[model samples]
Target: MCGIVGAIAERNVTGILVEGLKRLEYRGYDSSGIAVLDSGAIHRVRRVGRVAAMEEAALAENTNGQLGIGHTRWATHGGVTEPNAHPHVSGELIAVVHNGIIENHDHKRDELKGQGYAFTSQTDTEVIAHLVHRHYVQDQDLFAAVQRAVKELEGAYAIAVIARDNPDLLVVARMGCPLLIGVGEGENFVASDVSAVLSSTRRVMYLEEGDVARITRESVQVFDGTGAAVERKLHLSDVSLASLELGPYSHFMQKEIHEQPRALSDTIEQILAQGFGASLFDGDASILQGVKSVQIIACGTSFYAGSVARYWVESLTGLPCAVEIASEYRYREAVASPDNLIVTISQSGETLDTMEALKYAKSLGQNRTLSICNVRESALPRFSAAVFYTKAGAEIGVASTKAFTTQLVALFALTVTLAKLNGRLTPEAEAGYLDALRHLPGSVQHALNLEPQIKAWSDRFAAKDHALFLGRGVHYPIAMEGALKLKEITYIHAEAYPAGELKHGPLALVDENMPVVVIAPNDALLEKVKSNMQEVRARGGEIFVFADLDSHFHDSEGVHVIRTPRHVGILSPIVHAVPVQLLAYHTALSRGTDVDKPRNLAKSVTVE
Candidate 1:
């Protein structure tokens, strides 16, 4: 996912454009560029580095314009080079900043070559500039021109077009990728995320697929591809400026890893405070009653969350459930038995592959889908039959830590609701589970306090070449998430192995230089994970274990034990995930990688 922003502001405003790019940098950071419209022309500058570096370059070059579009690119079509950078200009006719891919570019490029249009950049995006210019030549209507150009193309794209001829008007459109129009006092804004414009203005409009926006300094209007004006309202978000602050942490990963306790507090706050979970869960149970089968679809960390949730759903509700990787699941044709339910999970709720998979499942006409998401206006909730919102406020980390933990908490609520509906859970068992779920916020707070110790351990292992994380049962997802967190920020090669599989191929990698992290919280699989830990320890691999306080793990030599609360079954991953997040955060901090905006990673993957 690439970050994009377009502003037709009131003053000479390259400064505001850079500010927008900084806010949107969480989307992508391979390269940054901005093109400002000044004196009836486009003044453009781009560089391969952080947004700050690009900002310095822009200042040095003294580029100025009242209106322009900026982009922080994650390369898809071409290499990470200036040519592949966005803010692509076509002969002073049109400059386009694009996110998502135009799949038919190869054929379109060939066709353009026959028309004597030479290409400068090796990107699918350059074709759009030419196409827009061609349409503008014929229709001479900027809105209709971009519309005609998009109609001729194929595949997913969200584009903002600035034409030299029509300097006052900006054309923005989206197909599968997300686009938002931010309403401000004398000007307007366009960005891939609400975060980019949140500080600028609170009132924002979400542009859905097939919606085209024509923006000016005074007014903004949205139209469909057929030139029909579409109606949408400005939605005020609860996110505040403080949520975007780094807040005395070395990295957003660390800040968010520590925020798990509070994040859980926010997520579970209302239901717990008002004693209203019965109503929410009661309604959920009625809606989900008699479902014969369940399918959970997600991607990346969300996928791992669903994978762990499968155990909770089946164990509690006795519902046969399948967890599928959303990207792969979308392409394959499958039949769903009637009344079967598909549950889609996403932190941003705009995950491209997950959205596609949900849509594909809906097309089968045999299953109803529910979206478990964090953001309210995100695409998943709009398309799904129902939505369960996870109220973890503005997660800015590219590799999710708090969001992952809180998602499990939300899924636990859903699982318990299903069990209650099916009469699978006894009153005693249900009461115990409910009480355990309520205690989880404090339990997570206790686990978060172990971060200092984990960070200390991170220092010793930062220089290590690789790491292996191991666990069993539900803890396995915690292990996978831990490894993913390490790889995301530290740039270290790490792998997660089911503790039982240690005697298999992964055990061969255990060595003095390797650090092995084990999730050995008190559970049925704790001893099994301990046995795997011993195998690694015997092979001279360094061991870091997060063990329950009651366990005799304190006597274990050669393995460092970070004591945590005793948790059983599905809830163990909640406490165990904190130390792993801390471990990755400190490792990345020690090595000096940009933790918040890790290289080649984005907070949202809007484009497939």
Candidate 2:
């Protein structure tokens, strides 16, 4: 995914474009550029690095224009070079910036080639500029030319077009991608997300699918696919620019890791205050009453949260639950029923695979859709019938920390509510669960206090090239999440397996060189996992166990134990996640890798 920002204002907009791009750096940062139309000509600057480099280049040129478009590219179509950077200009007349892929760009490129249009860069975005310029010559209207050009393109894209002839008008469109319009006094803005314009305006209009907008200094006109003028609701964004700051933490990842307690408390506070059972499905009781089963669709860290939710949902509600990877589920045939609830989980709520999976499930006559996400304005929330919005303000880290834990908290609240609705949980048990939920924040803070001990163990993890994590029952998903966090941030090779499955295959690769991480919560499977630990010890494997203080495991020569406070019964997964997050962060810091912006990974996956 790439970030696009366009500004049509009365004053100079070079600084505004640069600042907006900086706010969107979490989406993409492979390369960046800006295009400003000044004196009926496009002034462009491109760089092959972060937004800082592009800002420097733009400052060196001293470009000033009232209408402009900027992009921070993720580089899907070409390598990350100056030529591949965005703000592609055509024949000194038109400039364009785009996000998402143009699936039929090769065909369009050949046609433009035969029409005597020479290309300078190998980017799908470059073709849009030429296509618009070709149409602008015939129509002489920037809005109409952009509409005609977009009609010929295929696949997902959110594009903004600026022309030298129409220096005051900016045309932007979206299809199967996200774009929003910002409302201001004497200016208007369009960006991939609302965060880019939060400083200037809190009022925004979220453009729908297949919608196009023509924006000028004082007006914005939106049109639907049928060329009819459409009206969109202007909603106020609750996200504050103060949430984007680092505060005291050195990295966004660290700041987010410490924000888990507040995030989790905020996510479930209202539900717990009313009642997890009746208030959770307050107006939607009929939907839950008719639900025969549940299918959770998610990707990446959200997928691991779904796996944990699956265990809780089945165990509590006595209903069958299945967790499917969204990317795989959307491609294959599936069987679904009207009585099944399709739940999708995502941090950004714009994950392409997860959104497609929900649509695929809907196509199979499953209309009971529920989204557990952090953003209220994302595509998934708008598409779903019901939503549970986690209040994890803004997560900028490439590897998710607070979002995952807050999702678990919301899912756990849902699990308890469903259990009570199905007559599987008693009132006394519900009250006990609620009381524990109230205490969850304190327990999470205690876990964060274990940072010093985790940092010591990170030194050993940094020296190893590979790691193996083991767990049993609900904690198995936590192990998988831990391994994923380590691999994603530190670039270490890591794998996780159910503790019982170790004897089936994975034990053969264990030795002194491999670090075996065990998530040994003192649950029903504690003894079985302990035996698995002994199996690893028999093979001289270095054991690093994050166990409960009462699990009876003591530190020896090779068995290093970091006893987390006695784990909460059903909420143990949320408690155990803290140390896993710290281990990943400290290990990445030790390896000298980019902790906040991991290589080749963007915070949001908005395109297929």
Highest lDDT against the true fold, candidate: 2
Model 2 C-alpha lDDT per residue in residues 82-176, reported as the tens digit of each score: 98899998889899999988999999999999999998888998889999999999968989999899999998889999998887799999987
TM-scores, all models, native as reference: 0.96, 0.98
Clashes of each: 0, 0
Error of 1 at 61 (Å): 3.4
Report the CA-based lDDT of candidate 1 relative to the real structure: 0.84
**Please, what is the whole-model Cα lDDT of each candidate in the order they appear?**
0.84, 0.90
Which 10 consecutive residues of model 2 have the lowest summed lDDT?
A: 277-286
TM-score of 1: 0.96
Model 1, position 29: C-alpha lDDT score: 87
